[model samples]
Target: MATIGIVDTTFARFDMGSVALDEINKNASARTVRITVPGIKDLPVASKKLLEEQGCDIVIALGMPGSAEKDKMCANQASQGLIQAQLMTNKHIIEVFVHEDEAANEKELAQLMENRAREHAVNVVKLLYKPKKLIKEAGTGQRQGFEDVGPLGM
Candidate 1:
């Protein structure tokens, strides 16, 4: 059985860690362990390293950066760190983040975060258990949270 690790940031209200675990359990037969950090900037590197050391086959990282440019900068830094962690461990880390301003309101933002987390959890399940299906589901030009956004009025 595969073991999945979940790392979530607490700066946002959404409980991405719980949602991810639920989604993973529903779609796959893997076990999950979760850890929640204080903020988005704290998520990527240490979480991945700790989970890898714990023998996790896959890691799911969740964070919510604020609307400020500083938050964006921090998120970018976190991403770079995650990339390095992936290289060092040769393990997959699924980064799932929903910005505070991704939506027009708090409710919309929560929905977006939930969607992103659940979708990525499906990705996590597919990565280890069903690689072929994942390949077929690829090739989309949509942004991170755009896949399930439905029709947008431009």
Candidate 2:
């Protein structure tokens, strides 16, 4: 079983992410994947706690183009911070980029996001690549201790 955490910048994005994740979880192979969507934030503290408290096996930071453009680096930065935090606590992390504007329809977008998440899960489980740690300890400025447990393979 995999406990998954999802964070997005807006309600629409969150809804989309939730729907997509839900679909993924419905699959027989993903039946054990529990997902939570804790909408976006400027800081990672709250979001981090939610995931940690849930004992998430993997955290997926979902971002859309519009939201990503707002801070220019919001998606990238948040993903990095959350990944670092989750890793420090020994959880896996995956950054999922959903191209909403480019999507032909809502269904398509949701499907795309679902596919992306599935792919990410697969990579993490396969130990193919480790996501970079993006946050630094408050005072130490040192790499926190966390294993890059690969994504949950589909």
Candidate 3:
């Protein structure tokens, strides 16, 4: 069976990793390895370890960037690190980042976190077993936390 790695941040207001795990369990028969770090900046190293040491085939790096400018800058730096890790490991690290400002209220924020995580979990299943499913979705504007914008008129 495939092993899926999940790296989440404690700084997040919601436990999106659990939501992803549930969705992954429902969609595929795979073993999941999860690690909880302190903040978004910690995600890259934790995720790299999951792939390099824990032998995960794919990893989901989940983080919630706060609504401050510094937080956004930190998120960008963390994202660069994640990309570097992926290149060094030659493995897929699916990024699932939700900005806290994306939602208007706490309730909406929680919902976005759950929705995004669950959607990306399904993507993981596809990447592992049915990659062509994603090919069919290309350019469809498939948003995770909210309604898809759909394809624009060409």
Candidate 4:
């Protein structure tokens, strides 16, 4: 069975990692390894370790950015690092980040986190076991947290 890695942040208000794990279990038979770090900046290293040292085929990096300027900058830096890590390892790291400001209230934030994590979990499964599924989705303007914008007829 393929091994999947999940790297999440303790700073997040919600438990996106658990939501992803549950979704992955429901969809595929892959083994999962999860690593929890202190913040978004820590995700790159943990994800790299999971792929390079833990025999993971693919990784899911989940983070939550707060509604602040510094938080947004930090999230951007983390994203660049994740991209670099993917390039270094020649593997895919499916990034799932939900900004706290995206939602109006706690309930909305919770739902956003769950939706994004659950959607990306399925993406991880597709990358491992059903790549063609993604091909069919290309340019479909699919959004994770809210409704998909749908493909603008090209």
Candidate 5:
């Protein structure tokens, strides 16, 4: 069985992580290990490192950065660290992030985060157990973004 890791932060909505776990379990028979940190500042080195050291194959990292510039800086730093961790471990570290101000309202932001988490959870299962599904879904709106612009035109 494949072992998946979840590295999350308290700054994000807890339900988002819970939903991700449910999605993962519903899709595939796998073991999931979760590590929750105080905030995104600790997600990269602390939680992810611990999970990787404990033998998780791929890690799904979730964090919610604030709209402020400083928060974005910190998020970027953590992301860079995660990149290094991925290189060192030779495992995929899926980054799932939602900013507070991305949506006009709180409810919309929550929904967006939940949607992103669940979608990524499915992706985790597909990547680990059934890559063909992932291939079929590719270029088919699996990304967690505002909208699909399709191909650019002159």
Candidate 6:
């Protein structure tokens, strides 16, 4: 089973981070991917600890627009913190930008955020498992078959 640590910078509004997590968790293949949602403070440390303790294979960091500015600063700070955690723990990190600003096109922003998160997850899985050879070598002892079949038996 794979575990994932979820860090949401925007705890108040319906941020893209949680939505992306929901999408990931909804997949049957993600059934064993346990997710933990921790508070913003000490997020880097907490996420690293969760990865170590829970044996999480990946860490997902979610960012949202802040009350001030375009929330870019907050995102940058959060991303930096997550990067530090990744460097220290050597854990795979997926930084997702969630849009919650009403000034922008909310629907378009949401779609873009969701797409980015999905792509990040795919990339993380590929990097961790080396899927290209695995796909070709599956059932040949070179690669382990899917432990938990994804939806549609991906």
Per-residue lDDT over 23-100 for candidate 5, one digit per residue giving the tens place of the 0 to 100 score: 898998988888888888787776457555777888888999999999999889988988888887777888888888
In model 5, residue pairs whose N, Cα or C atoms come closer than 3 Å (at least 3 residues apart or on different chains), thus clashing, are none
Please write out the lDDT profile of model 4 over residues 1-154, one tens digit for every residue.
Answer: 9999999999999999999999999999999999999999999999999999999999999999999999999999999999999999999999999998999999999999999999999999999999999999999999998999998975
lDDT of 2 by residue, 102-126 (tens): 4677777666665665555444443
Candidate 3 colliding pairs: none
Worst 10 residues of 6 by lDDT: 141-150
> Highest lDDT, which number?
4
From the highest lDDT down, the ranking of the candidates is 4, 3, 1, 5, 6, 2
Instruction: After the best TM-score superposition of candidate 1, give how far the Cα of residue 39 lies from its true spot, in angstroms.
Output: 1.3
Worst 10 residues of 4 by lDDT: 145-154
Could you estimate the TM-score for every candidate? Answer: 0.89, 0.51, 0.98, 0.98, 0.88, 0.61
Model 3 compared with the native: what TM-score?
0.98
- Backbone clashes per model, in order? 0, 9, 0, 0, 0, 1
- The ten-residue window of minimal lDDT in model 2 covers 137-146
What is the TM-score (0 to 1) of candidate 6? 0.61
- Residue pair clashes in candidate 6: 29-150
List the candidate 2 regions with Cα displacement exceeding 4 Å: 9-14, 28-39, 67-70, 99-111, 121-154
- The whole-model lDDT of each prediction reads 0.83, 0.51, 0.95, 0.96, 0.80, 0.57
What overall lDDT, based on C-alpha atoms, would model 5 receive against the true structure?
0.80
lDDT of 1 by residue, 1-154 (tens): 8899999977878898999999998998877788888987777665676666778898999999889999899989988888878888888888887888889998888889888898889888889999998677565443555554433455
lDDT of 3 by residue, 52-90 (tens): 999999999999999999999999999999999999999
Q: TM-score for candidate 1, please give it.
A: 0.89
